[model samples]
Target: MLDFAIFAVTFVIILVGAVLYLYPSSRSASGIPGLNPTEEKDGNLQDIVNRGSLHEFLASLHGQFGPVASFWFGGRPVVSLGSVDQLRQHINPNRTTDSFETMLKSLLGYQSGTGGGATEAVMRKKLYESAVNNTLEKNFPMLLKLVEELVGKWQSFPKDQHTPLCAHLLGLAMKAVTQLALGDRFRNDAEVIGFRKNHEAIWSEIGKGYLDGSMEKSSIRKEHYESALAEMETVLMSVAKDRKGQRSQTAFVDTLLQSNLTERQVMEDSMVFTLAGCVITANLCIWAVHFLSTSEEVQEKLHQELEDVLGSEPVSLDKIPQLRYFQQVLNETVRTAKLTPIAARLQENEGKVDQHIIPKETLVIYALGVVLQDADTWSRPYKFDPDRFTEDSARKSFSLLGFSGNQACPELRFAYTVATVVLSTVVRQLKLHQVKGQVVEARSELVSTPKDDTWITVSRRS
Candidate 1:
């Protein structure tokens, strides 16, 4: 077990180094007090395990080491920046890459030819970016279709009690993102079902540093992962083959089919986008509902805005911009939930943050968990007050990092739209109430989520 554990962490470091394109491979971490440019990293699995949950562990580290601290994760140079100011100085550099992509490089590289060099990966990333930009407007209708389906499902449930939203939201997000990303290639429900099964297996392994083959030690999970991955590739290749020379406006795959990336590369990108889109967007919706349930003042404000902007009407894209309060609700949810608890970058050359020297080749993490709730920056930092974002204070920025100005996370922007729509639709129709005695603590996933995450009750407003 010890031998295998060491091997996994070592492999993960190389894997992260290879696929994380934005990170400078050379040594460069600066601007942190007492950080050694040449400090040796300890490679002990027990050390990592002893630390317990990564999110809680990082929070504890911030308490002990101040906002910025250096530590070793199995020989990997890690620097954690717990404050917003630290982020602005170092990670807020325009070129920072989304840390979510690090997990993608390894997980999506499941069998696709990736992590070799940045060339193909870069090109493929561009193509995927193009697909998203090209297809989001075209796909918004598809998104609404899925949203309506979800609403219908919820509407059918008994009105007296709460529904388990986590599982259902996962399905709703999976189906919507799949249809948009894969186009008609995954039209069959079975195909979507199969993809979801594989996705669950793969997603659960993320953020745990992809712990060796033990994650797939279960034969069933291993089987589903491999089979679904192969199916997705076959689907993308077939679509790319047929549509490369054709013109289609509705599907993301159609946009990709026109790209220079090979079918496998396209498939790899599509898979990542699909899986990530599902998890992040679903949780965003969940957290929004969770927050709303806990804050009746915010809920009333949001519902009033939704009713004022879109009363007795179905939610539409044109009206979304007018749903300002709903947007604040979602933003506040992300901020309070710390949906993305951390983001990181690698220093190619020694860098500095706030006059402190950061050593070279260190993983500089933007500890969003700490800053999003900074008492100095936010009035009542722990509260779920969306009104803090009213126009009088709207100009204030950098506090809500959910999907703010950082375009590093493509899916997050997409999720913002999806979540806004969900809030618009749900708040207008039902009043959310917290589940009595339901435990709703934050558990750090790749995206932060409520622990033992269940659902809130809702009743049709009179």
Candidate 2:
């Protein structure tokens, strides 16, 4: 009996070893002619398991491997590009899908490829129409009202405890975005906040799971995603049902309903629309305020622009375009901080890159954060100089990772408008300052955000 047990144990161990040995590893295909399984970079797997905070690990590899480097994360192959020229190759409009959506589907357990294609198309059309006609024309007044509410709320909070700017910014973004996306039905409602909480919780957890490689195997992530989706569907459907008899407004949900989308598509697409705007806009606001507080020069320049454009009156959408420096500051913020650092895509059919051929259906990631900060493109790449975007030196075809022409996320244009309005309104009224001895750091997820507890002080500018 002992001999038989030993034999079985040895057999299992050998079987596992054989499988690991046969698994294809990631390799640099830059100078090579064809795809071949290459040896894994030492410590690469360990860094991935550490949840993507291993900046030193990735930086070292890129330094050694040149502009294009390949590495493995579990059973997946990741290609990192560190130059604008190479990055542009992957951003060709011919590519139908983006890396962000691919990572999202994988994390959320949705089907990839054509799964979200119809919904994506409808959402894109509605977003374009809304941006061109609805947002600036129809929704600006409501947005201003929402901004006023946020300011009032800030005033209500005790001065000493006013440091929770991150939380307040998130709430403000949610209120404004939801009002525009789903109408005023769920805006500030308890149910809406609850749904946002569930969705955020699941989305955030899945990011952690992906970095740790547990999402692929974790039952907890599966349950969280399922629950969040159900809750989102319920809330959106309820809002839609309530608006059934009413004439459609210019809001996103109204536009979607008027389109040929089915009820499920309406619910899912509406949730994605709202959630995407809230997290990103909120983070941008938080970071902008933090940066302004740290740099008096930037703040002064921005205030000058705002005052010159619309002095002593509330900011409006019509006036946003005239604030050139303010716009430059926002563009620089996105370029320097990299809100959405990584963009990804998958090969539909076999495709060639340089000399090597990528197999059909292989996942490809473009680490936009790395590429955006590439030394070759931007002089003093790590510096936060808004002047880089000024008319004298700004690249005519400047592309940041947030939205590229081919790989652009449709929601980005709206996000830019919302962020511009919110920032302009707040900066015009308040003088923001960072608290002494406090540190603000970025935490990357599906979208990067200031560390959850980031705090700042606000006083009315005299």
Candidate 3:
């Protein structure tokens, strides 16, 4: 009886080992150590859903498997680089084109390519940069006006009233992007409100649907999402038609019209930019203020810097660069919050990271969340210390993470400028205080925001 029991145990062990060895090799195209698909068709998709978000799943995946890892995203094998060295190997400095466009378009279900050839893409890229430059340089007063209005509203609130910080920031961001990118049509309160409603519907779905195919599964939800997208596109199309053939680069749509892109291409680009711009700007401000509210020292330092740079004067574009400490705090907020936690670029040619060979057309994910909080890369990485950004090594790590110098995306560049202006304006006037016993937890979606509506009260500073 003892001999028979031993044989049964040995047989079960052998079977388990065989399945582990054979099954993963079927899905894992490279030698990169990571997860295999639990199911054949869905790949590691359900795993992502179970783990909360793509960012969370990647964090755990990299924790188990070293820096460079692999996982099946649908049928395609995805290679994720989670450390500075791995990211350096994957990013190409010569390639100045946008990397997130393809991934974003895929998630949004926008099928049209950004023109047909490489030349067309390059033309569009130049026009995009021109639009951003023109929007900031030519329309500085409009941005300042918007910030003043927001601050005025905050001041109107009764002293010690707990203001809903996220809602206000989201509204301000919507107004800023729609007015600056689209046109004055969005200046109407009704138009801005309607646009915000649709933006919320689409963005909420895009974040959820990217992880699970649940949005498409329900006919009602699928129709509602498509309807919201169509409505936003219609608004963009009208704006484009109004600006067609006009040489003035006042708004983003006008600048794109100056190029040879088809109206459809122009509309698509505008939608992508508007969607990305609003979410990023809103959450960036939310996290920055929330962090500052928790730390009085950080707030005092920012206030001191504002006094040193511009005493009792509002922030201007020319003066933004001189406020180095303010920029450092913003940079630190981005790192600590993992604001835009993930970004991806498709490898067109076969590439090598360390010893692993990446096949052509493989999707390479930059796991920015894991790298942002890596202990080796940043000391006390989880703590909200802006001083860490003052070091050369810390700056290099952030550069490798793609938030510095020429690597920052246009939307981020826009957000940084807007945030600098907004945060500086508010901190100089009012002191932000967190509501007692209110613990804000991050809900990592396309952008990391507080899981619930975050609230803070303001007291006029003396």
TM-score of each: 0.82, 0.82, 0.90
Q: If both were scored by lDDT, which would come out higher, candidate 1 or candidate 2?
A: 1
Ranked candidates, highest lDDT first: 3, 1, 2
Number of the top lDDT candidate? 3
Q: How would you encode candidate 3's per-residue C-alpha lDDT over 370-456 as one tens digit per residue?
A: 888988798998999999988999998787666876656678888888899888989888888989999888877667888999999
- Candidate 2 residues 1-462, lDDT tens each? 000001111112222232222345335443332223333422245654344553434455566776566665434454555556665565453244233433444444443333457467445544444533464467888888877778666655555554677887788778777777777675657856786687686667654555544554668776776777777778889887776557756577776666666676666666656666677678777777677777778877877888888888878777877887877777777767767665555456666655455665554555556665777777888888888886543443254343523334545556667777777777777666778888767765556677656777777767
Model 1 misplaced regions, further than 4 Å: 1-11, 14-47, 92-99, 110-130, 209-228, 391-402, 406-408
Clashing pairs counted in every model = 19, 1, 0
Clashing pairs in 3: none
Worst 10 residues of 1 by lDDT: 1-10
Clash pairs, candidate 2, are 99-344
- Per-residue alpha-carbon lDDT of candidate 1 for residues 209-286, written as tens digits (9 for 90 to 100): 353334444677656656766775676566667667765667777776676656676666676677778888899988
